[model samples]
Target: MSHFGFENDIHSVLKLDMPITNAPMARWQRKASTSTSAHTGALSPSKSANRSLSLSKTPSKTPGKNGKTQSTPSNAGGDRFIPVRNAKQMDVASFLLSKENEPAEESTSAQANQQANQKAWSVTLNGYDLEEAKILHLGGKPLNAPEGYQNNLKVLYSQVPTPVSMKKSRYISSAPERILDAPELRNDFYLNLMDWGRQNLLAVALSEQVYLWDAAQGDITLLKKMEEENSYICSVSWSKDGNFLAIGTSTCKVELWDVQYQKRLRCMDSHTTRVSCLSWNDHVLSSGARSGLIHQHDVRVAEHHTCTLRGHTQEVCGLAWSPDGRYLASGGNDNTVNVWSGAQQTGVHCFTEHEGAVKALAWCPWQSSILATGGGTSDRHIRLWNVNSGSCITAWDTQSQVSSLVFAPNYKELVSGHGFAHDQVSIWKYPSLAKVTDLQGHEGRVLNLSLSPDGSTVASLSADETLRLWKCFEKDPSKKAKPAGASSSIIQQHIR
Candidate 1:
């Protein structure tokens, strides 16, 4: 019967249980007007000395020697004389009035100069003279606004906006693109056994043998085979040009091989223990060992051993160089992540938040200052650090042991491989750390992960003796792919 009862009946029918209160409606109230005003007076100009009253100026005097007076020099450049002629005295007001009454003639040069010196105070926007009301409505305007106010708004809203090609959300295949049998791929979390080279070649170490799979040709080649009884390939890395491959072996030796020629360049033995991880920064090869020492080898020179970094107290497993080659990040079995400043002997920042061994390290390619590190089973946290600040930016618990982390160069996302609970590779949106999707196929721990040169595919090696290539980050259609063998040309240029 009443409005409140009708509303209550409607709510009851809709199954909404909101409490109804009999509150009074709001009403407008007028404020009391006041005649408060301040009295103002017109400004009067300040008095100044009239130039006509004192036309004569005092002559300046120069300082004399020994305070003796001397005749002052004439400041006038030429003839300081003027002919005095009889003239009639006239009132200044009459003189001004006569000058105003004269016919004015403006010179062309003077008019041009004046026009050139003056600046336009008004601006023409989109061929429309903007008024005050139009400017006020630049953001938005009311419905009852004047017609002129809509000119700017019409100009702003009329042009067809660039149709932003809405990027279709990439459909990541739950199934892998290609699967290859990686027999005897070591299950050791401390060892980095796979690397994707810039030449579109994927290198994988399976015990005593190292194999290279060319993505372009889809051909497998045995790059190297160990003949020694106890020696095995522990880690693998490729040079920036992708022409040379660096292999860390169990016998505490680093072998450099020329990929194009298929020949061993040289062997640089520095580590006393097995080399666990290797990274390349231009010509410098950084090798991390189980003895907790990292050696910098100048592969270009005969004296390959250049420097040693001593910070990790245990096995140094993870090694990644920043994209710009400014900093090198290493993770060790001591549950610490150490950031070293370019070939330095000690770490600049030692992060000890990880309770488990830190093994996964990846630098953001887009942001040079950002470094991502993941801890082992005990910690299971993926921490992003601002390397410039020497502080952790953010950390996320993976719940599963993080074995590897690699940032997608094209997308603002991070892909991490996990070990226990679920041997799954997870795609996480960065900065937010929101899980995008979990790629589950590996039966065992996903021990290693590497991104391809084009940043489209990820090569993941698991302890289940399988290497899966997933096309998670697809390339933009507008961009053209790099010419074939571009890295080979780069290497040839270096050789020349």
Candidate 2:
């Protein structure tokens, strides 16, 4: 009071307790009493009495280990205090702050490693790079090696090449070339020849008329005209010997053309709706309609009536006969493929796993029992089946919907055409069902594809209105190379 007399006088005049306001202290006292009473109600009677006795004995102004009065701050609110003498000891606040900072650092490092790895192992395929191929990383760290490090690096480097290999010999030959561009033909109808021989080659069921192209001179000349009066022709198929061409019109009438006479052979009235697909063996001709009916005609006899072979529930899109002439395969818009056989049409097999409608079907020339089917909205897959077991052997996913499909004459590969994209054909290796190559060059949808008799050439007809030819070279010239024979004179001298 003598040294700080003036401040003491001012404090005495103001009459303030401990030179600070006491309102907060009064509220904290009330809160402490309420908390004590609640805890006492929760504790056992003996425990509460012991706690009260201990509190009563404790001094109001006791000093803590830090040499400070153990009085809580009046306005500290609900914050809890932790005394951590060693800085390494963590409180909840500090622990949460560390967790918040860790993920950011880890994410940054991971992103940097990913970018570095992508730059290291980049590759290319079909003029498209690895990024375009969408190669995904399963689980591995980025490989890093020093320059000129050859100890174990050679083996690792050898495995780093692209998985896809592109060779010109693997190209599909049946890709179409631009011969004509006619948008007037709404549907890219499939073409068939009544006679495959040089003189009487006739292209049937064109947009407005039937086109008879000159095979002898390599010229396309319109031989006959049928008006596009009502419906368009959907499909055309030639008989085994190429004597009769079966045309499926939009009206569902199976029109037969006699190639030898260049005249209408006979019109079979069996299908109830537009016939979308047609196929023929040596003696039997089968046609499929939008009404899902499969009509088999015995072309061997004069009376052509529909044989009862009905199992489809939607538009019949594909039909083919086994090479041995024992089984018939039919595919339809119902996403089901059926194989029918037996004396009384009793044996039947159904394949219904395709996610889309089966559009095209073909029997393997070498393995007559093997059948392949391709079609859907996008025709993205080609499925091969074993006819006897009704089991799928292999499947291939393509880039587009398969509009047309044909097996190679040697049965070593398959050629498939997409619906909208012209000048493109997919070549698939047989047995393994691996995609060997994709042929690109057409300007329209490839409507039909066929393999030549010798397996040396493939022909494709496109919606672009041109028939294109592709030459196949499956032979390896290196295998034909011969070594020089040892001199005969040297052999004779040694013998002497």
Candidate 3:
């Protein structure tokens, strides 16, 4: 079995034109009795001298103390390269494949496999990336895309975005998303008139009748009609869960309606004067009265006011509870904003900045301590306060009478509806106190404002007897689908 003779046979089978030069390399072999090649020949002495070098097999692994190798055993008959150094080196295929797929490999450095990690996402924009090479992380998963990441699906390859376009203020629709006539809506300034619920229903009071308008379906249902003479609907507040609607009337009686059944569930007539304003916290209903007193009614089982809050000198017209349902903000014609800690029956803090009546009240979405209060024609200012310390954070002169204010649930902005000259809805860039835009459509003074659940739209009811919807802010369902675990520190939010 001359090695050169075997080479001639392999060369005849493979039909090689170049002569075999590398000797220490191994050649293909078969079982002792069978071979794949059909030809047979004898090798020369020079080639046979190098044949031994190629015939060497990889070294075998030494048995460990536990008497076992941790790696998978290689198949003896599988196609593999036999390293000349040892007999049990096993197969180097996995390692060789890994390097072949590497960004740089010696033999094919210039033409290495260009495939990249498809799940990777590299960031390069300012504030979005720490540096050009730094990979972004989401839920602790690194987005270290390959150097030339054409296959990275997590990244978007495009032109650099314009910064000025992003920082610019947004303008809302000049026309409403909807317009409906509130023919019987009361024009009184001291009355709390309407509220929107998470159930996609807007409850509006028309004279003595309470109607529920389905914002999603455009269907309206009369929830209740006053049964007593001279009794009319004055205030309406939706329960936190949107399962019920609380109605306060001119009879000083507060009634709860189960929205699911469209029927009255309970009634409480504890106030001496007309029930003018209403707000809800969980199962508790707080009703502000023309008597300048606030009464808390436990809707769970009570028929009377649970506890009375005596603070205002005049009518308590505007009222709001913190989202947590732990604190309350009350505005009275006495030109005062009362912040009450739920722990106490009386107001723990009182702020009197507005010279006229304070009617508009809104709690900041991001900063819970911050409260916004709007004044009447004489004051014409929207003031933000730190409820905990009773310090005024910022205030913006609306110029017109501040009728109502509501904070965008998702974005850091608050919208105020004004009366008098403008009768406008002004959206300010929140804590910054910069006006983003003012929307005007109503014919008369804007009396009340309410926000839709899921925080997409706002409904403003004006004294012109028209209800308008403002499509203010909407959330991207895709980014919302991302796991909440993504860190805001590196999160890139598109604000428009």
Q: Top model by lDDT, which number?
A: 1
TM-scores, all candidates, are 0.63, 0.58, 0.63
Look at candidate 2 and give me any clashing residue pairs. 378-401, 379-401, 379-402, 422-442, 422-444, 423-441, 423-442
Q: Candidate 1, residue 58: CA error in Å?
A: 99
Candidate 1 residue spans exceeding 4 A from truth: 1-167, 343-346, 477-496
Please say which candidate is ahead in TM-score: 2 or 3.
3
Better of 1 and 3 by lDDT: 1
Candidate 1 is scored at a TM of: 0.63
Give one digit per residue, the lDDT tens place, for model 2 in 265-292.
7788887788777777677788888888
Rank all candidate structures by their TM-score, best first, as comma-separated numbers.
1, 3, 2
Q: Pick the candidate with the highest TM-score.
A: 1
Stronger candidate by TM-score (1 vs 2) = 1
Model 3, range 1-496, lDDT digits (tens) per residue?
6999999888786766766665453353333113213327876657654554444434355456898854435765334765565433434766667766776445464343322221122232232333332334343434333322234344433244433323333334555666778886789878878899989999888889888888776777877899899778899999888998889889988888889987878788788889889898887778999899999888767455679888999999999998776689999999998988776766778988799899899887777778899999999998888887888888778789998999986666788999987998988776777776778889989989999998878889888888888776765433322233533232111100
Q: Give each model's whole-structure lDDT.
A: 0.79, 0.64, 0.76
Q: Model 1, range 163-272, lDDT digits (tens) per residue?
A: 23223324566777778888777778889999999999989999899988888887778889999996789999999999999999999999999999899999998888
